[model samples]
Target: MTAKFASLSCAAIIVAATHAFHPSALPSSSRRPATTTTTTTRLPMSFMADSSDYKADKSDFGDGADEDPDAAPAPLRGEVDMADVPVTEEIPVPMSRNNVGNRFLAVVLDGSFNKDDAKDAWEMHGDRIALTERHVMWARKQNLYNETFNLESRADVLWSHQLLSSDLQRAVGHAMCIDSPTIEDCREAISRDPIVRSLLGVDPETGMCDVSPVPLYRWRQIRDHTLRIDDGRDGLPNMVMAFDRPEAISDGLREEVSNDHLEYLIRSERVIAAGPLHVATPDKTDPRSIAIGTLLFFNAVDREDAIEFVENDPAARAGLYETMTVHRFNSLDVTGKFVSENLYFPGQNTYQMKEAMEHWGYPVDDLQTKWLNW
Candidate 1:
């Protein structure tokens, strides 16, 4: 069953439909910088909408509406095959949940960790993985787990946040978003996890790990859009980017820039997930509650390709974001169709969790028993 589930998960395809954003009603600004690259040029019609909507915009096809016979075909409209699928009012598209409330992106870095040096740390590492999975299971029960993933290239651990260390020789960590009412509650959650505390490397006697939660007020993902998780982009590395907005940028300018940004992302078709990062639940009527930045998870040919993609965005060019960092990341399909269809079992008290841990080669005796108790 484990092997079969693994095989199926690897072959899963995720598809997301493009969202249409009509021109913003707010005032506009030409803050978007000019680009020399043809790929970055704005198209005649916004890619954020379906290609069928722009059939009249013949400019998209060269000067061959009725004159030239050699012009190439118009762009293919993105569509999903739902022939055999049942139709219902609530079709249960995965990852469409509007998980709201106070959430923090937590990062856990292990400085002494090296994937190659796993001999001595293997037992401890397994314990950590087992414990973290247990934590995720608990979070799932409490409706707190949003997403959990580790750095694909570096650490074996997982959590989400960015921390800079100058003297660090090597570091591996994971990141995740946890729903907690307050920062103190977030810290307590981290503290209760023994493995996380050890990973923080705080001195046992007097030292303490102080977690300053990076509050994510709101997260917006296109509901109907599905992405093929197994799209043949094996050569490309997945990327995780966090764009930080400078306070100086006003809501009007950011909204104007988003029009171009969204179009570029849709046209690129590399986006796995892309959305605005709000500091708090935003009121449509309140300009002050507007999103502060953007979070993009996508695929790129390489590091350079990822950098270029973000750099070419209208928001980046307009200096809307104060800092935008892109890093190569490996994504786990947690909270997505991959999890629900493969590893997860509805209700509880199943051996699903045990099977998952065993498949990952983690010692599951205690962890599995603990999970069953919940």
Candidate 2:
């Protein structure tokens, strides 16, 4: 399949008749002609060519003559000189969760970025679709997976609203793929990216940015899409999981917080509601009188006394309730109650919540802990 050719030099002026042979019509042996000549002076034996030389030249005929045996011959109108062409290699496009195969469902949980809850949710529901964060720094620190998580604040939605550009919002989601060490680390890393800071209009020197208030209706839409939950029994749609910002809850705002708020909090306690059990339907002596059970969390000083009252109360003694689940942690941070003087205003929180709200562009004036009442 391979051939080599060598150069020859001759000084004697001896010529022989040359004939071109049609490669297909001639036999292999006859394809190459034997060269013979008579000379007047004695010539060196080197002048007599060897059959090996001829064979080498014949083997290399196609290449030396600029012909390709493997390529199809062109039309008789013209002869085409064939040359080897080098092939080019293709670059690959990066794979992302959005473009991966469609065996998995993509769920965007609209909630506060609780690292532990996010991990648990992924384990529970992230079948094949890679889970990523909107937080760029978190992505880098965790270096946990090959995917990027988007951590764009409500600002993305606000921008979308102002500009009416779905494409811009989607692009922001796409750009969140940077790697990070941990969730906190990722936020820090993202904060350092100049492009991100510019897009969010964050000032590096002052650590401040101006953001627009999230339209209430739009926020609700985003929340619904992200926090879908499936209760584990009877295939009934009973509950949806979400990260609730106590600040966003408004009192008497039926449009925002429906009666379902109480139901959601109760369900969050992991209690099952009973059907049609009543304590008020009492005929004091009627055997049909039934008791009702309810769960409560108390932060009272006399805990034992409070429990006793519940146990001895007619409603409590009626077997309407079974037990109380109590959790006592160091009560730090603001509780959801409005103080008369409004000391715990919106802008007066610790770094985490304040920074988060500021990033989202919410007004910080006169905001009370009552704003968080659920």
Question: Which candidate should be chosen as best, given lDDT against the real structure?
Answer: 1
lDDT scores in order: 0.43, 0.25
lDDT of 1 by residue, 1-374 (tens): 00000111111121111111111111112112322334465556555365555433456547554765677545434432345345535322223132334444444433233234443434544545555555444333333222332111111112232222111111123445655444455555555444465544565687665443212234444443743333325334343434444453445667777778778777777776667755443243346545656666676655445566777877777767654544444333333112322112223343675576456433344322232212
Residue-wise lDDT of candidate 2 within 1-374, one digit each (tens)? 01111111111111111110001000112111222334565323332265453233343235456766688645443332323333444323223322221111011121112233443323422321222222332222222112222323211110110000111111111112222222233234445433333334466688854321110110111123112332222111111112112222223232233334344433443222212111222132344332222222222222233233233433233322222212111211111122222232333445454455345333233222223221
For all predicted structures, in order, the TM-scores are 0.45, 0.17
At residue 42, candidate 2 shows an lDDT of 38
Off by over 4 Å in 1: 1-104, 107-171, 179-196, 199-209, 213-218, 222-237, 240-247, 280-289, 332-374
